[model samples]
Target: MKRIIFFGLLFSFLGLKAQEQATISGELKKWHKVTLDFVGPEVSESDEFNPFFNYRLNVNFTHSESGKSYMVPGYFAADGDAANSSATSGQVWRVHFAPDEVGVWAYEVQFRKGKWVAVSDRDTPGVSGEFMDGAKGQFMIEASDKTGRDFRAKGRLDYVGGQYLQFQETKDYFLKQGPDAPENFLSYVDFDGTFHNDGHKDHLVKKWEAHLVDWKEGDPTWQGGKGKAIIGAMNYLAEKKLNSVSFLTMNIVGDDQNVFPYVDYDTYDRFDVSKLDQWEILFEHADRLGLFLHFKTMEMENQGLLDHGGVGAYTKLYYRELIARYSHHLALNWNMCEENGDWVKNHKTPPQFKYERLSMAGYFHDHDPYQHHIVIHNGNMFEDILGSNSMYTGLSIQTHHEDFHLVHPWVIEWRNKSVEAGKPWAIAVDEPGDAQHSLMPDKDDPSHDVARKNALWGGMMAGAWGLEWYFGYKHDHSDLTCEDYRSRDAFWDQCVIALDFFNSLPFWEMQPADQLIDNGNYVFAKPGEIYVVYFKTGEKSKLDLSAAQGELEGRWFNPRSGDYLKKTIKVKGGSSVELTGPKKDDDQDWTLLLTKK
Candidate 1:
């Protein structure tokens, strides 16, 4: 509270005027990391930028020595059609600032109107350089003054009568390792066929050991019968701090209990429907690794048809038996099912199916004496199918065909709807593009490109738990087979690369926002006091960030060379920013982290 008051007092003392000073307004906290957008209603049909109401702006600010300007990272528009009564929208003017220096500063925005100009303040050439006088180092410009009074290039002056505030600059922010620490930008990897007990050639364990770790098998028996494999995988994961083992199912698929009657199981007797005492070892082993088991009560596509031999009743008895058995263990989530949609759709009309599924879900929700969180995996991405259902606790949409950049918009949509419906939301993607199915051309595969993009952007915008890559016998897509257990882990090569990409980001519990600067490429930006942009499609695109106001510091990194490219840039107000870099390569990706300096 003291800190907030101190900053507020400092700002108040910077300057004062009649409430009608030039105004610029934006949210203090950005959805993503880059640009702050102030959305206002559009009021006219005038095309400022020729056909569209576009106004170009050049933002100039005091840098270390002279002045500096750089292109903002996203899209901006003032829509005149957005007005219901007095509300109007369109690109009134664009502003961009790359402050190389910090402290109290004043800057001016030059706006060039196209076809129509309403007020003289917006119709002019250069506007007053309002003093946004007190900020730290290297952050995005977001603060604004209340008064909306400024000048135009042709000497036309307009008074906005204390409506909005002008944007300010950015500062340097650091992180700590505690709960309130800076943030845990993450690095995640999907160790599917690579490190499992089935043991394929583990490339990551040998080559990129510095950047890779073992992922816990979904269940103890999921590791296969090779006891050494379990120890080896655990040792490796613990060494790398890959400590969280989600979906730690104790029941061995195809072994313990039969999910489908078609397959026979040697360990079918191991289920011991009468007692759960046998499962303690699995939970104990996970606890020994400093790991939390994201225990899923059931896997997907396994629940038998309700009418088939009364399996539904048997399944309910099993859940009751299990929950009564293992509900006391420390788990991450009471995972309802790997694919929750099958349950809802199949069980929709039947009282037994619907009621049992709903009842089980409610048991986890209401009667879990352990107070654990309930998270269910849904098939479809739209909230109506999964989120709107009474059984769902949070939302997890597997990214099958979508690119990583779409995570932000999806999260925004989910959050807004959840708020309206009065529910707390969680956004997670356990699967992205299928690992086996390369969904792209050799160099032009949008799917492959989106796969990597999804890993990064998912964490950035959706606040995802991280993405999962499915790996098993290509033929055993549905169930595990003994033949599927190979000593060779073929996909570790890509997994190592993906993990490196994840670790390279800053992903500690970042929130989502509706604020955006759409550059029209795969690149969509969410700016806070800092800016984070995702360039998908593996293509270079141009962005008009003239409306962006702040000091900027960023670099382009060659993911292949592991080298950072330093370039000096100054964005003109409302002008398009041209991006240059490699277009396509498996490892050819770049990240730009800009803060107002």
Candidate 2:
């Protein structure tokens, strides 16, 4: 009886194994054709590019029989690793599988040694088994229409060598640094210029203008209504060592340097000038006070400039004029739009919008006489284009709770690709949303820790440019008065707390991880000898990182309390360590600073 039962159980297990071994049949997807749109200053519209260029392409696929799912191998020829890989950085040929199967799958197409190929092994040690694993359960090789009835994936092959490394030329060309540049110009720490409290606003403006604020058109009275307002804002920023400001669309009105936009062309002309005199005064002030300026360029949502031909036209034209206009002034970055491109692409047809915006980017880069660090302020995470086969600058997303976690893997992927390309990359959370909004913008809220840290830690772990926090336009201006907008003085203090934490780390000593250590729960970064691990939830949590490194020494720093405790930390070789921080309920949660001697 026992033997019969044992045989029955063995046969049952075998039956399950047989069910899991289903093979998906489908034709290998191929490239339909190549499409490229070079959007320069002269070219306002889109066109076609002749292809069949000399480059390698790889096709990747995965599927399951049980209508469940599994992760198809990621494209990994360049870096030569798959499991701890991302599809964003390399040449991604998105396989459009027909949704004939009930399960899930992911396919990545990449270029390798001038030829396109496919693989299904993502793990470095190359492990393949049943598709029951959750991480590997997202792929199903069925139907997909990336370009219409196309069963295969399509992407252009790009030179993995020095040919593509020249995008750095664009960075250098656009962001050339003058001797007078601020200390942390590239750090991107800045003030909100739209505070409603006239006094606070004036304080901030004057504080910075005392040394900064170079302009090309209109007069921004440093002593008038505008001047007073600017002064308040600058003074506040200077008090805290925060000296850069990216003005929203409100910085200009036609030709005037006021806080609002012009009602018409006449209103705009009131402040208009071929040379912005007001900006000069402000620039001179900024220079004296040592402040940096980065105009948000234009607001795509409220102004509808892309279609109107005025504001958008002015944006492109102004960048050209401003670059030459303020070439001597130290500007930190050319922030393309206030979440314009993402909004359009996601809400509209992505392919069309992406192509159109790419043209705008090209135009901006080509026109800028001074090398500027250009960035796209994406309204959502779905539009991160830094991973495209073609080269572009880094990207930033306005993360609200709506999809905070949704962006981590993507960010990690882009970082990997950027590292391979040898280009500096960054992503920041610019919109924490609002209290009334579904995403909730409370920086002090503990519930938001998972979401916020997901963005901040993700960026840090992935070797991003830096992390940024937005306090909403309404909250920023709620304290409007004759003086600068109500002072969020303490708010800035907290910001410093966060930034100071970032400054303590070896900024240049890190790079994105080629792979992630999966502990069944949390993901960590292995930068050199340190295991930078981040836990998504729980107040006090301990992790077994013995699988991370052998004979590791550790110390932990409390980011919130500025407390550094040195204790002999250990995770035996091939084992993990157990550590803890405040519980999720503790608003005063902490960050563990792990290091080795």
Candidate 3:
């Protein structure tokens, strides 16, 4: 509170407003990020680009069309020349804005210069910086016409108090299918402050040379044609029908120190604009290719590794920069921390650490202009953090054990708990199986029978929002070092089948009902209108569809082959129906669908 007050007191001494006016830069498209440059008092990077203190500039934008308003904090761009040139000295300061509305939007700027470590408001007797204190500007935004794989066409995906994420514009519920392998997935050579020859936390080294062929004609590249391999990796995933990928934006003290936005390994505040600029290109391509970016902020060991604890000045600066630059993206979520259980050493009390994490989430939730979904990877401990008042909106879980059977009960438990707390949480099995041997390559375990039954079908059948495959330590590509996405070639087909099955049905309308199943199988139905059941045992059993009214048409779906029986089976209303086992035998997994006829 003292710190907040100190910053708030320095606003009164701000110098008289100068005649200079501010200008808006970049394209002005609805749902696009815009930069407003404030050319004022000259300040250079050598003078300390540290935004923790001294001076601060903030901006507020209001939509003229609908009267919507968004107030966001700003940062000094170190000459505002970092993107094109490395000039460390200049008079330009900038703020980024992403307008969600069309038509015209007006903005106001407030800049303060002080000798203190923190400054805000206009109360100090020593406030300075005359040129930008009262500047304002207006820009026009237009609708987007992009379609097909472009996620912008669908608009922002938000947590609308349900068990699933819904697109803001199209109102379509999303189910994610993609790779969660290679936790160090962002250690690309083309990125800033990265080394390709480095090894993962497991000490396994990979050059990612095998994925070079996957880089297509139109994929983006950086550092003057050096990003083909990394960008190509994304191309392959999109081609495989997968739509999401998880990677750490910063793991300086963890598995891979090769991926971060800093100018060096230790510095966290001065971001390398050129390197980050290249990243924006790839992310933009991912956007057009229809990919959901799951940004894992901090790994297990480094949760409290910062200068101050989790909610320190460094934390605030990092989150602010990330939100300002990338929050315009439509499909993505911020994983506050990955495996966030090892920070107990940093706090005087264990529970205090938990509150600190929650505090960070709360801070992010309140500041992020778009309010993107915020979740944290867990150590299976989410008791005090499951209520509607909490900042978390989903679950990013990690488990031990090869079969994903754990996913079913866990997701069901969290969903049930979140619902009981008045806000249903979107659950995704981020990392399943133990750290030793998680999801193996298709070449090693081509069938993937156990995984499909548990992690894929089990979680979804019990109401999960998404699933990402994790590679085990025993494989050629462990969770940290794996580069070739095609290593699990055959497993992708199974993922497609699961996602397709759900997409074909109005899954958003279906509710999980374990009572509707007579056998040990799973049941997802609208109660009376539609019934879809998963038969993991593939044994001939009776399904109690008696509560369902009217006659229904039934069919058998082959989970492995992605094929369904065309012929309809009769299911009379208010009566139990007998289901036959799959012709392939007891080892197979099959699904049954019955629609009112």
Query: RMSD in angstroms, all models?
Result: 26.1, 24.9, 6.4
- How do all the candidates rank in terms of lDDT, highest first? 3, 2, 1
Model 3, residue 263: what's the lDDT? 67
Off by over 4 Å in 1: 1-226, 238-279, 288-292, 304-317, 320-331, 343-358, 380-392, 399-416, 434-450, 454-461, 472-526, 537-548, 558-563, 566-576, 582-587
* Model 1: lDDT of residue 394: 53
Tens digits of per-residue lDDT for model 1, 310-383: 32333433343344334433324566665655545655636544324455566455434333445566552444
Where is model 2 more than 4 Å wrong at Cα?
1-229, 249-271, 287-292, 302-315, 342-355, 380-391, 402-410, 413-424, 434-462, 473-487, 511-528, 535-550, 566-568, 582-588
Tens digits of per-residue lDDT, candidate 2, 42-62, equal: 110011210111121222334
- The model with the greatest TM-score is 3
lDDT of 1: 0.35
Worst 10 residues of 3 by lDDT: 116-125
Score candidate 1 by TM-score against the native.
0.47
**Stretches of model 3 off by over 4 angstroms after superposition:** 1-26, 40-46, 49-53, 78-92, 115-128, 194-207, 342-355, 582-586
